[model samples]
Target: MRQSSAVFRMIAPLIAVGVLMVGCGPSPAPNSAPSLSPMPVPAQTAASDKPLRVAPAPSALTPPVGSLYKNPTNNRNELVLADVRHTAVIIGDSQAMPAGSWPQQGVAALGYKLHVAGMGGTGYVAGNGKTGNYIDALQRGDWVLPYGEPPLIVIEGGGNDATQHATDAQITSNADRLLAALKTRYPGSRLAMIGTLARGINNGGGRRTEVDALLGRIAAKHGVPFVSAGDWLTRYDAIGDLQDGVHLRPAGHAKIGVVLAQELTALGLAARPDSAPAAK
Candidate 1:
C-alpha cells in the first residue's frame, strides 16, 4: 500500500507540469469566418460623395434606309441619301414629262427643285421608226434646260428610240453625242441615266431590250450609273405601279420618285442648295 501511494504522487506532479507547459504556449487563433470567405459590401464613395462609375454598355448607330445602293445595272456603289438642298435637271421622253405631274412630284422632293427638258416624241435617237432624236433637239436650241450645270443632271431616253425602231448605230451615236454635249454643258455637275421600261426583268428579246442594253453599254462607257428602271420596278415589285406597261400611274410615279430619289442620293448628288454649281 505504501509503495503504490508514493508512485501515484510522483506521476500526478509530472502530468500537472505538462498541462501548465501547454497553457503557457501561444493562445489559439480566434475562429474567423473561414479564411477564404468575405462578406460583400457596397462600393466606397470618394470624399466628394460621388458614386463610383461603371462603364456604359456599348451601342451602335445604324444608317437610314436608302442611304446607299449597289447599282444593279453597273455594280457601282452609289450614295442615295444626302441633304435635299441642291437643284436637279431631268431629261427624258413622255414618261418623264407625262400628261399629269405625279412623277415629277417625287423628283422634286429630291432637292430645292427639279427641272425637266423633254418632249413626248423626242428621245436619245431617231431612225427606223422614231424621230426628233434628243441630240438634234438639244443642239438646235429646241429644248429648255433650267438651272444649267446643277448638282445633279439625269438624262433618260431610248424609249422612243426603241419604239420607233431606231438602229443600234444611230442610238449609240446619238446617245454618245448627247452625253458629250451634256458633259460639255454641265462639266461640273454629276450625271446619271435611267434606262427604258420593259414588260419583264429579263432583256428578253426585242428592240426595247436591245435599246436598253445599248444604252447600258453607253452609260458604262461614260462611267455613269444607269438605273435600269425595268429591273428597278421588278426588284421593288412595282410592275403594278404602271399603266399599259409603259406609262407610270400616280402610284407608279410615286414609286419612281422615291426610288429615283434614293438613287440620286446614293450617287452623293444631293447637296445644300447654296453649294450647287452656278449657272453657266
Candidate 2:
C-alpha cells in the first residue's frame, strides 16, 4: 500500500507538468478579424482644377514685329505715285506698298494722281540686297528728279530692318542719316516716315514696340510727320486682311489706303475738296 502511494505521488507531478505544457502551447490563430492600417491619400493642388494658360491670339492684319518680309517678286521696280493734283510720295516695304495703294486708289477714285515709289523687302539700312531697300533706293535718286520740282518724299521702311535684327541704335542712326540725306539731296521735298503695322506672332513681341517707338523719336527729331500705322490699321479687327501673316491682301490694302488718305488730307498733304475748311 505504501509503495503504491509513493508511485502515485511521483506520477501526480508529471501529470501536472504535462497539463501545463499543453496549456502554454502556441494559441491557435485568433478567429477574430485581422487588423489593417488605413491607406494614405494625395493632397490636392490648385493646378489640378485649372487648365494651363495660353498666350493671346495673334492679330490677323499685323505681321509679327521683327518679322522678315520675303518679297514675292524679286523685282526692284520703282512705283511712281505722281498725282499732279495731289502730290505725295509713298516709299516703303511690301506693307507700305499695299497700304500706300489705299491712298493712291483713293486719289485716283477722286480723279487725282499720287506717286507711290514703294519697293518690297526694303530696309532703311544699306547693304541688304532685296530691291526697294530704302537706303539703297534713296541713295540712287530713284524718287527725285533734278530738273523737275522736287516732290514730297514719303519714306516707309524698318520692317526688314527689325527682322534682320538691326539694333535700336542702328535703326535710329540709319533713320537720321536717311533724313539728313533726303534733306540735303532734295531741299524742297517734304519728308515723312511711316511706322510699322501691328506685328504678329512671327515678330517677337516687344521688338516691334521698340521699332515703333524709335520711329516716333526719329520723326520727332526731324520735325517731320510720323504716321503710326499700328494705330491706324486697327490690326485686331482687320487681321484677316493679311495674306501670309505679314503682307496685306487687296482688300486690306484698300482699307488702310482710305485711312491714309484721310490722314494726309487732315495733315494738309492732300486736299479734301468736299469738306469745308475748319475756322483757323
Candidate 3:
C-alpha cells in the first residue's frame, strides 16, 4: 500500500504539468482578452508639393471696366465709368487747359462734353518738355481718345508755335499730318480750327495775330471751319482781361466762351437744344 501511494503521487504531479503545457501552446486562455496592433498611416501625395496658381493684374493696354482715362480739367487722368458720346475733342494749348475755358464753355452751352487733349505750351509743331508735339502725341498714343465717333474735333493752338518762331512751312507740315490723321481716324466727325487768341494790330498784337491769320488761311485750304480770335482782344475790348501777356483770366474765358458759342450757333455748329442734335 505504501509503494502504491508514492507512485500515484509522482504520476499525479506529472499529469498536472502536462495539462498546463497543453493549455499554454499556440492559443490564448479562455478567460483572457485578445491583443491588437496599431493601424498604419498613409504616405503624403505629390499634389501637395506643387505651386498654387495666382491670378494676374489688369493691363493698361486694355481699357476695361474701372480703367482710368485722361481728364484735362484738373490735368489728371480719371476713371472712365460711362459711355462717352456727344463729346467734342479739343486739341489746343494753355487757352483750353482750364475747366471753365472757352472751348469747354462753348461746348457745354451747346450741350456737349469737351474732351481736351492739349496743354499749356503745346501746339501743332511745339511740345512741353514732358510731351511731344500734337502730331507726335497723336502718333505715339499719348492721349486717350474717346471711344466711338465724337461730333466735333477742334484743333486750337498756334501761340506756342508762334512763340517759338516756328516757320510757316514747319507749322503747315505738322498741321497737315495732324489734320490727315484726324480726318482718317474720325472720318465721320466734323473738323474745325480755333486760331490763337490775340489782340488786334493796334493793340500790341505781333506774332500771335500773324499766326492766327496764318491758321485762318490754313483752315480755308483744308476746308475746315475756322474761328479767328485774332482781333478778339480789341473786338471785345478785352485788353484788360489778359492775366499775363498771353493767358486770359476767368472773365476773359467767360467772354470768349460766349462769343465762340454765338459764332458756332451762327455757323450751324452749336447744339440746338430745341431740336435733335446732328453731326452737321
The best candidate in terms of lDDT: 3
Tens digits of per-residue lDDT for model 3, 1-280: 9999999998998999999999888787795655677454444556785555544566644556456655443343444535455677888888888899887787678777777886688888888887888998877666656655678888888989988888898898898888887787667788889888888767777888988988989888998999898889889977788889788889988999899888777767764343554553
lDDT of 1 at 251: 78
Candidate 1 residue lDDT tens string, 1-280? 9999999998998999999999888655786444466675445576756656655555422334345444444343333434322557678888788633434654566654666776776787752233356877766545555322366677776777877788888888888898897787667777888777664436343566667777888899998877665455566666777777667777777776787667766766554557544532
Residue 132, candidate 3: Cα error in Å is 1.5
Q: Which stretches of candidate 3 lie over 4 Å from their true place?
A: 1-81, 272-280
| Total clashes in model 2, counting residue pairs 3 or more apart in sequence or in different chains | 16
How are the candidates ranked when ordered by TM-score, highest leading?
3, 1, 2
lDDT of 1 at 63: 31
Pitting candidate 1 against candidate 2, the one with the higher lDDT is 1
The pairs that clash in candidate 3 are none
- Model 3 TM-score, all chains together: 0.70
> What TM-score do all the candidates reach, one by one?
0.60, 0.57, 0.70
Number of residue pairs clashing in candidate 1, backbone atoms closer than 3 angstroms, sequence gap of 3 or more or interchain? 10
